[model samples]
Target chain A: MIRIANGQGFWGDSVDAPGRLVEEGPLDYLTLDYLAEVTMSIMQKLRRRDPAAGYATDFVDLVKTLLPRLVEKNIRVVANAGGVNPQSCRAALRAVARAAGFGGLKIGVVSGDDIFDRLGEILDAGCPLANMEDGRPLSEVSERVLSANVYLSSYPIAEALAGGAQIVLTGRSTDPGLVLGPMIHEFGWERQDWDRLAGGTVAGHIVECGAQCSGGNFTRWWEVEGWDHLGYPVVEADPDGSFIVTKHEGTGGMVTEETIAEQLVYEMGNPRRYVTPDVVADFTSVHLERCGPDRVRVSGARGAPPTDTYKVSISYLDGFKAVGQVTIAGPHAIAKARVCAEALWGRLRRAGFTYQETLTELVGLDSCHGTIPQPPSHLNEVVLRVGVKDRDRAKVDRFGKEIAPLVTSGPPGVTGFAGGRPKATEVVSFWPALIPKELVRTTVTVEKAAG
Target chain B: MRRVPLSRIAHARSGDKGTGSNVGLIAADDRGYEILLARATAEKVKAHFGGIVRGVVERYEAPNLRALNFILHDSLGGGGSASLRTDAQGKTHALALLMMEIEIPDDYQTPYPEGSPSKGPPAEGLSAPRRKSR
Candidate 1:
């Protein structure tokens, strides 16, 4: 059995997790997933400002901290920290490794998932790159597209591992691909090994969110212990496509059939068909059993061939938006908050400024669930949040200016407006499309740290 | 028949998918699973959410895990960064769903008994503790 553990759930996850995962247990491979749907667009914006600033900078510091332990323990690292630019990330890692005196460190770089430059060529070749949600053609938002990347399979990651790199960095790969890649490399699983691929993919999904599968977000929060030092999830995967989901000994968090069940259905669409680039896993067929303390054995995961097309994540600057909030205190807080919101909108309209979309929420009351039955008759305070979105940046900016004036002009008890006027920020919206699998190609290269 | 909140028999977790949200409701036991399968229909769930959800609701069964997955379409204002609502990702939708009340047989036994710590005091205006059959 190979021991693989996930440390970082997302880009802004716990900073101490990666090092703690290495120090706490026996791990053969460590995987970190950093990319989310909108992350690539942010990276693209960063790259446009400074050529070498696109990738996850936190990853470089993390590797610097864990490099010694990783080399001593012979642990291989796989991560999608190379957001939009793996070459620059590789260079940064090479510099860090060399400075840290691990000159012989081999880092693999995976590219070709990014198709931003080739969008016109591909679209001209008959692939419309239409939006999957509304079936809108790309021509509607072509000029505003910020980042375009295909969700690559685990094959390139596995190839990098086989090339003898201690660390593999990729761009726009699936979250499960980071874990499944090591399984493919260590067990030598072929591309068509549907059952085994499905098994690894299932394991990947469980631990990808760090402690969410363990105890961090369990529904029975009262039953879980050791919140200060919760153990992240680890997988003891076998070649037969079955795995054990457990954490380190004497660590916090409980891993039972129920916790595993909750995580199994997290962010899930269809239980019968969990689609990834490698295989379409049948989540409904998965069997979970409490084999031991804090250990759940998962088996019977079935799979079928993947689709002919690969889903592409594209982000564009939809518009500009600004949100501002103020606190209303004293009795009748909810009523006063509503009045404040109305007066702000009323002032904006009188100034000859109207936005494309506007939202007003009394955050403390029914903002979340939308007017649940029998709300409390009285409250001490309520936060009045107002926002506006528009194609014209000036209109959104004007809406932001209207929020702070409510502190002195609008209501009796308005405060908490110390932050001043909210600035209009670009709204980077997600656009999911599909491209034929054959149209995308991936390349992997291994480079040694320059001493 | 007696009505109790679904939280007494099941637990849930939810997350967003573009403009929609997926809630995974898992029963506490085999009997609870049957209760959910019978009472937590897609139509009922849609009605329970009321104006909170704008589009259709679809439910899928996962018998292996004693769980039912419900997908609420067009629920978020726009979802992700595009959404203007406070709960852009629908993280609290699971607890909102657990607030739903379902009718059970008068003689039925629950894993979380009445007055237990897990089953907190009944919400205001609920019928006082009594056993009856419809």
Candidate 2:
């Protein structure tokens, strides 16, 4: 049996969680998932600006805080904080470990997802980096691309673990890979163990967000107890691939059927066809039971083979956009908000500030559902959120200027327009495409820094 | 791009509020999504193109459904000026479709992977020393 704990849910999760995880209990492995889809692009921008700035600096700080306990507790660490730059990320972590006087920490890095340098080569090879949506090519806004990373799986992570590294870092791997990698390590689970791999993937999904499964974002949040000190999730895994999902006892948050259901529903697609880099888990086969306080036994996950091509996360230039809002109050507030929206768009059109797309909605009034939903008859107050998007920066900028004028010109019940003119913000877009796994090679290397 | 599991975000019905709706741009990862908050309009725009393209932008809302698939159609802009598609072009189209933005927490930082040397000694009592044989 392996006691695995998820310390950090994302890059910016609670700073003290990782350290607390090691200090508080018996944990075999400490896994952190920092990379998100958009995070890769941001990291790319940072890497371009400063060679060493691309990795998760927070991870270094967290490592610095937890190194002693990590070493003392025999807690192995794994994370995909590598974003677009794994080598740089590893070097930063090495520096942090050295500063802590812990020389020779075996840190492993998994990379090769950053295909930026080979963009043209791949295109020349006929990959066409076409937009999964509109079929647009990258040449449209290639210059504006801040970052490009392919979704990698747990194979590299397993290699790193097998290579005897104490800490393993990765660029853009699937979230489940973080948890699945460790399971692969302890149980010697083979890559072809589809059922076992799927089990790990399901377990990873359950604990990916730490406390989220333990009731962090419950809609019936009021019913939850001790949320202030919510306990992160822990996975007790067996060689058979079945695991128990629970949180540290004496911690805040509720581990009930409702909470589990909420998380189960999160990011879920086809209950039977949930695909990841490792396996396609079937949620329908999953069975959950509350065996004890804060302990939910999760088992019985089914899975199948993964897609031949890895889905890539591509973010490029979309368009410029800006939004501004105002609260409408007093008699016929809904009416006033609608008028404000119409007037704002009308005014923009009259000013020749036609955006490729423009929108105006009254938060509490109009159903805001594409069509002007019938506002509640008694809605005396509503927030008019108006925004626009266009390939032209000037148009979006102009859209921002129009919002403030509405407070004085559009209608009587306008008020929430505190943040001056909505600034023209660059639109970072997403492109999901498929690439043969062979085309994206992941390399795992372990390094030891001098103290 | 983060794909919002339809089951999770099916409850996310934002259009009723006004002119634009909060469409979840599901990515392979959650990389720039936080920044998407400030750039929500881009996500919204991407959502608008979901139906027009030949493909699909997965969006499903059912009690039994677990994820939303925003099946994107042909918004990749007809493969751009060159018939050949570059990785950048695909990513650009994904971003172009974004319309709604949500603010990521201020503490958000990007994480990356690193390579470590193999000659390091093991910790005193925690894990066993590196095994030479597999």
Candidate 3:
């Protein structure tokens, strides 16, 4: 039996949590998730200037902080911190390990998800890279794409583990696959055990979001206590592929059936058809019970065959957008804010500065109005936020410039528009599509740094 | 298609028959779901059935938990004993029909994001309970 613990759901999670998870509990493997859709683009921008800057730098510092304890305790680490730049991530991790006096650590890197250099080649080879959302081909924004990654599964990670890697770093893998890979390694589970494989996938999903399953975002949250120091979830896996999801004893968070249930429904779409690269688990087949304090036994999860295709997250340049807000105060503030926003758009439209998508929101007035069914009607102040997105940056910039003018010309109560115009920023849009698993190949390499 | 809750499904009693398993369907959410599950679990179910299930397709409804169930024939590759994924479409169909039978609770609500294609729909039905944010 092996105990696997996940310390991060995404980049920018609690810095001390991973170290705390290892120090406070007994764990064989530790995993962290540190990448997101827009994060790739941000890292790409960072990499353009510095060759060693594309990966998750936060993870390097984290490793340096936890290396001593990890080596002392014998806990293996796996993470997808190698965003867009695996080699750099490897180099950085090695540097950290060496600096921490751990010179013989072998770091494994999983690569080949990056298709940035081959975008035109793929398109030229008759792969349109069609947008699954609108069915538009990749030719639409091939030139504007910052990053394109095919989400890989846990197999490559298992290979890394077999290769004697003390730490495994990956780029653009399914979040759940990180935890599932460790389980496959610990249990010696075969690839054909779809039932057991699906069980691991279910466990991954339950704890993928870090503290979320423990008490980070429960709807019945008031029932929980000591959330100020809520502990993240840790999984204890047995040889038979069964596991118990729990947290450190005396931790602040609550792990009950309701907490797990709420986490299960946090961002759910279809209850019965939960899709992952490993298997499509039947959420209904899952059973959760509070066996003891800080421990919940999750078992009996049923799974079906996995889909033939994997979802690809492609973020491309949609357009440019800029938003500017001005606070309107005093009597008739709401009306004044409305007129100010309209006057800016009217002037921009008259100046031939049109946008593909334009929006105006009265933040203090009715931001969550329509959805909540009852939005406040009376308000003494309102913040007028006007934004525009278009292929033309000048047009979006023009829309931004029009907001501050309301203070002097359009509305009497306009104030707090001292920042001038909001800068025109590139709009990143998501494209969800599927590619046959066979078409993509992931490779893993174990590298050691030199002095 | 039937709909059931996790709470209701937990109370369900599962029976085994010499490695072959039998459990009544209490509720199912949609027809496509059973298809999804069958695609993932055809081999395992076949192993449990001790081979292929080739007779009639049986169906039952659990309004309380909202599920359905079906039983298949000798579909397991090794004479209803081995669990392999290379099953025939008929066997896959029978397995898809079988998943609809698990009983779900009346209050079974979805517990995670379903990774849908559409973007910008604030995940509904969550009321933010005020507590110190962690």
Candidate 4:
């Protein structure tokens, strides 16, 4: 069995979790997932400002901290921290390794997931590049498109591992691919091994969120112990397409069948068809059993062939938005909060600065779950949060200025506006499209750090 | 029959999918699964959400996990970075769903009994006051 642990759930996950996984356990591979749907756009913006500033810099520091141990333990690392630029990420890692005295470190770079520059050529070649959700053509927002990347399969990562690279960095690969890649390389699983691929995919999904399946954000929060030091998940995958989800011994958090079940259905669409670039996994066919404390054995994952196309995540400049909030205290907090919101909007409208979209929420009352008919009587305080989105940055900015004035001008007992006026931030919207699998070609290259 | 909140026999997790959000409800036992299968229909879930979910609610069943997943379309004001609401990702929709009350037999055994510490104190004024039968 090969032990693979996912430490980072997203771009801004716990920094200490990855190092903790290496220090606390016997692990063969450490996988870190850094890219989210909208992360590429942010990276693209950064690259435009400074060429070397795009990739996840946190990863460089992480490798620098764990380089000596990683070499000694022979633990291979796989991560999609490349963002929009895997080569730059690899260069940064090489510099870190050389500085840390691990000059012989081999880092593999996976490219071709990013298709931002080739958007026009691909679109003109009869691929409409239409939005998957609304069926809108790319022409509508093509000019505003900042970054476009295809979600590559696990094959590129496996190729990197097979080529003897100790660390593999990829751009825009699927989150689960980070785990499944090591499973394929260690077990020598064939390309058409549908059942095993599905099993590995299921295992990847369970632990993709790091500690989500190991007590973090669990529904039964009271049952899980040791919130201060929760354990990130590790998958003991075998050749026969079954795996055990467990954390390091004596670690915080509990791994039960229920925790596994909750993560199984997380962000799931059709249970019978969980599609990835590698294979179509049947989440309904998965079987979970509690083997021991902090261990859940998962098996019976069935699979079918994947689709002919790969889903591409594209982001564009939608508009600008700003949100501002103020606390309303005293006996009629909810009522006063409502008045504050209405007056702010009234002021904005009178200035002829109507926005494309606006939202007013009484946070302590029903902002989250919507307007519940009977909010508790005699609430002490409610935060009045007002937000506005518009194509015009000035309009969104004007809406922000109205929020703080409510303290002295609008209502009684208005405070907590110490942050001053909110500034308009660019709204980077997601546009998902499908590209023919053959259209996107991925390549893997391995290089050693120069002394 | 006695009416109790669904939290007595189930747990849930929710996250965003585009402009929509998915809530996966897992039962405590086979008996609770049966109760969920019967009572947790798409129509009822849509009605329970009120104006929060502006679009349709689609439900999918996974008996292997004793879970039912509901997809709430067009629910997040716009979802992701485009959304103006605080809970743009619909993260709290799971607990909001657990707040739904259901009817079960008086002798039904719940994993979380009414006064059990695991169930914790009842949420303030979530449910209507019980009326004494004449």
Candidate 5:
């Protein structure tokens, strides 16, 4: 059996968590997940500004911090911090490792998930790239697209491990792919081993969010202890594809059936067919029980081969958007907030700029659940949040300028304006679609840093 | 029949995809599941959400787990980075569903061992308890 732990759930997760994972206990492979759909466009924009600035710089720095411990323990790392540019991320890590005297470090860089430049060609070649939400073709928003990536599987990552890479980095890999890759490399699991592959996918799904399975953001938050030092999750895999979910010994996170169950159904749809590039994992087939304190045993996962197409996350520059808010307090809070919003919209329109979309909400009173069935009479304060989105940047920008005047011109009891005017920002939207398996190819190259 | 919020007997979790969102409501036990199967239909869920959801609602029954999954199309204004709302991903959407008042048969007892709504909605300032991740 091998022990795998996920330290970083997302790119912006606490940096200290990874170091804590290393210092706390024994781990064979440590995985980190970094990319989100819109993050691809953000990284692409950075790359456009500077070729070397696309990937997560925090990860590069963390590697420098972890080099000594990683070398002493011989622990391999798998991370998808590559964002839109795995090659650049590999170079940055190589430079850092070479300087830090880790000359023998064998780094694996996986690429080809990025298809930003080739999207136009693909669309021109009869690929509709239809939006998964609606059947609209990608061509409608093709000109505004920023970055396009195909979610890759575990094959390239496993190949990297087989090539003796101590650290594997990939661009746009599936979250569970980071875990599935190590399992494949360690146990030599075949592509056709659908059940085991399914098991591995489930294992990855549980730990992919790091501290989530380890007692963070649990629904029954009152039952969980050690909130100050929440430990990330680790999975123990056997030859039969079953695994035990646990955190490091003596760590501060609870691993109970409830916690595991919560993570099992999170951000999922159609429980029976949780599709990935690897296999179709049956979320309902899996069994969960509290085997021990801070430990849960997971087994009996069913699986099937994946579909013929690969899901692509395409991000585009939708439009410009801006939101600004001010607090209105003392009697008639909801009414006053609404009045402030109406005044702001009037000001924006009078300036000869109408937005494509506008939204107004009394945040404290009815923002989340929609219009309240009944409003409390004693309500004291509420924030007035108003926003606008438009293809014309000037309109969104002009909308931001209308907030502060509401304090004096519109309603009374208006406060909460510590920050300057909210500025217009580009809104990057996601367009998820699929392409045939034959249209994309992934490659992994393993090499040592040159001093 | 007495009217009470669904949270009296069930727990829920929600998430988003593009403009859509899904809520998974799990009954506390066998009795709760039977009650849920009878009352928590897709049309009812759509009605509960009303204008908050912009498209059709789809339901999947998980009898083995005593859970019902409801997909609310166009639930998120635009979802993810595209959405301008505070809860763009609909992380708190399940709580909104839990606040729904439902009809129960006479002599119905909540399966939840903790403080449950045998009478009406959960107390004010009471957060819809459960977990959110992913």
Candidate 6:
């Protein structure tokens, strides 16, 4: 059996979690998932500004905090903190390790997931890279493409582990692939071990959100015992293709079957077929039971081979947008908020700037659900959140300047406008497309850096 | 039949993928699951979301877990980073769908005997994550 813990859920997740995870208990592998679909474009912009700024620098800090324990406990790390640039991330970590006087650590860099440079060549080969939803081809928006990366599988990562890499860093690898790769290397599971691969994938999903499986954001928030002290999730994997999801015993959070079940459905599309880079997991075949306190025994996951294509996340320059909000209070707060929203837009229209899309919502009443839910007739206060998106950045900037004027110009109850003005920011739009698996080649290179 | 909010019998979690959003709803019991499969069709969900969702709604059943997954395409204006809305990542979409009222048998009650926490707390503090949405 092997123990794997997911400490960092996202890039800006609570700091000290990863170091505390290694310091708290015995752990074999520490996996951190830092990339989302649109993260590539942001990282691309950062890379353009500064050559070494693409990766999540927060990850480097976390590694520095845990450097002593990681070497002492022989705990390995697998993280997709590379973002758009894996080599620079690895080089940065190497510098950190070298400065700390640990020269025996080996960092395995898994790159080639980034296909931005080769997108044109691939397109010329007759693949349109059509948008999965709109059916429009990528060629329509190729001129604006900023970043295009193929979602990598576990094979290259597994190879890195087999080559004795103490830490693995990847770019654009699937979240579950981080766990599955280490499992394949340790258990020596074959590529055709579909059930085992599926089991690992399910285990990864359980703990991918950190505390989500360990009592945070649960449906029954009241029933959770420790609200202040929450434990992150850890997976205990057996060679027989089953895993037990649990947290450290004295930790803050509870890990019952119900808690784990809640995370299983989070952000899920088709329950029966959860597609990862490695295999297509059948989540319907999953079986969960409460083995003990803060422990959920998970088994019976089935799977099949993956599809012939890899889903590529292609981001482009969509436009610019700016959002501003003002608190409207008193007897007719909702009505006053509505007036403020219209007045802001009316002012923008009169300024000869028509936006591609404009959104206006009352924060307290209909912001969350839009028109789906009905609010009460009277409300004490409402925040008028208004925003506009347009191809022209100047137009969005003009809309931003109009929000604060409501305090003196339009609504009687408008008062709480604090921020100077919401500046127009570039929109890094996501375009999901598929690519033939054979078109992209994944490579892993391991280099020793720290002791 | 009697009218009741869908939250009386189900729990939901919503998230986004590109321009699409998915709301996963799990029933309290098998009886509630049966009610959902019978009433919460794709058409009903699409209609419930109305203009907020620009595309079609697709439903997938997970019988073992007593859950239904609804994928609403073109739900966000574009998606994270690209959408101008406050809830760009579609974080509170579950609460939106919970407001949907459904008709159920008058005699059939929820499995829970006491207070209904499943009704969900009011939607508060919806913000898009700058670094990551998942």
Which regions in candidate 5 have their CA more than 4 angstroms from the true location?
A: A372-374, B104-109, B113-134
Q: In model 6, which runs have C-alpha deviations exceeding 4 angstroms?
A: B104-109, B113-134
lDDT of 2 by residue, A174-219 (tens): 8888889988887888767888888898888878877887777654
Q: List CA RMSD, all candidates.
A: 4.2, 15.9, 13.9, 3.4, 4.4, 5.0
| TM-scores of the candidates, chain A only | 0.98, 0.92, 0.93, 0.99, 0.97, 0.97
Would you list the C-alpha lDDT of every candidate in the order shown?
0.90, 0.66, 0.67, 0.90, 0.85, 0.85
Candidate 1 docking category?
medium
For A95-118, candidate 5 gives per-residue lDDT tens digits of 999999888899999998998888
DockQ of 3: 0.02
lDDT of 6 by residue, A196-260 (tens): 99999999888888898898877666578766667888899987679999887677879987678
Give me the chain B TM-score of candidate 6: 0.82
Candidate 3 wrong stretches, greater than 4 Å: A124-126, A369-371, A410-413, A418-420, B1-134
Best by TM-score: 4
Question: Candidate 5: TM-score?
Answer: 0.94
> What local lDDT score does residue B116 receive in model 2, on the 0 to 100 scale?
22
Residues forming the 10-long window of minimal summed lDDT in candidate 2 chain A? A366-375
> What would you estimate as the lDDT of candidate 1?
0.90
Candidate 4 off by > 4 Å = B118-134
Give each model's clash number.
1, 100, 43, 0, 2, 7
Which should have the higher DockQ, number 1 or number 3?
1
Supply the DockQ value of model 4: 0.59
- The docking quality of candidate 6, as DockQ, is 0.45
